[model samples]
Target: MAYCPKCKGEMPQTAAQCPHCQFDFPVESPTGEGARTGFAYSPLADFALLVSMIAATIGSVSTAIGSIVAVFHGHFFEGLFIGPIAFFLQLGMLVTFLRVTKLGEEKQ
Candidate 1:
């Protein structure tokens, strides 16, 4: 799907004009050069991913430290369980976010 820049309406990828606003899309010349419609990079999503990664890193480190403290305090069960679980959960979340956004795919 593509968005109509003029009317902000959703339309099929094959559409040459916006149905809602009747805005015609620009045609490419015979040389095959025209305006590109999609984005090369989304700054907003990138920023979000950066922030999430930072948060996850901090959380994982803290969890590890907390687990060590717990072990030193003779709470081995709590130390072992909480740290790995939190770390893996954050890692899974990061993976899911990356997959959902398709951020690293090659353009072809």
Candidate 2:
């Protein structure tokens, strides 16, 4: 279930060299320090996502309140602006979270 680094081919678990490309494989240490494992969540990315989500939530709430107040004040155009901007910001944050999560998964 291992892949040969040189030939990019499937090699047997006990393979020392890639049969297809005659490339020598790096022997893994008994401590398992040489082989690359699965992907992990990066703390910085997670922190950024958390912050974005919080900001998006706050922005959305504020936008709703602002739009409602503006509507009551007869400022239709102002309400329109605030509502769309808030929605766009929330959508952007959701998309960002999804993209980063997908990237982390793919790296595994």
Candidate 3:
């Protein structure tokens, strides 16, 4: 099984498009290797991904704590704003990390 880069949906290796999102797989060469469609992975990309994931984790935890504290202190608006921001930031980081790692694995 392989993951679709666009939708992150699981698909069979022989699938031409993602069943969930209809994302077309890149054409393969006659030698059976898929063509590159995005950034080539490097040691630098791996390092950046690691750092980003760590930062996102820390940020998410801190923001969640802070939001909870704010709500306890009667700052509803602040909690509301901070909570969603943290959630979206963490979600973005997770998706980015997954996509980069998946693409990197394909190269190997």
Say which candidate scores most in lDDT: 3
Off by over 4 Å in 3: 1-40
lDDT of 3 by residue, 29-78 (tens): 64344443334445676688888888887877788888889889999988
Model 3, position 52, has a per-residue lDDT of 86
TM per candidate comes to: 0.47, 0.48, 0.55
Q: Which residue pairs in candidate 3 collide? A: none
**Candidates sorted on lDDT, descending:** 3, 2, 1
lDDT, each prediction: 0.73, 0.75, 0.78
**lDDT tens digits by residue: candidate 2, 35-87:** 43433335765687778877877877778888888889999887888677776
Error of 3 at 25 (Å): 18
Which prediction has more favorable lDDT, 1 or 2? Answer: 2
Which stretches of model 1 miss by more than 4 angstroms?
1-42, 94-105
What lDDT would candidate 3 get against the real structure?
Answer: 0.78
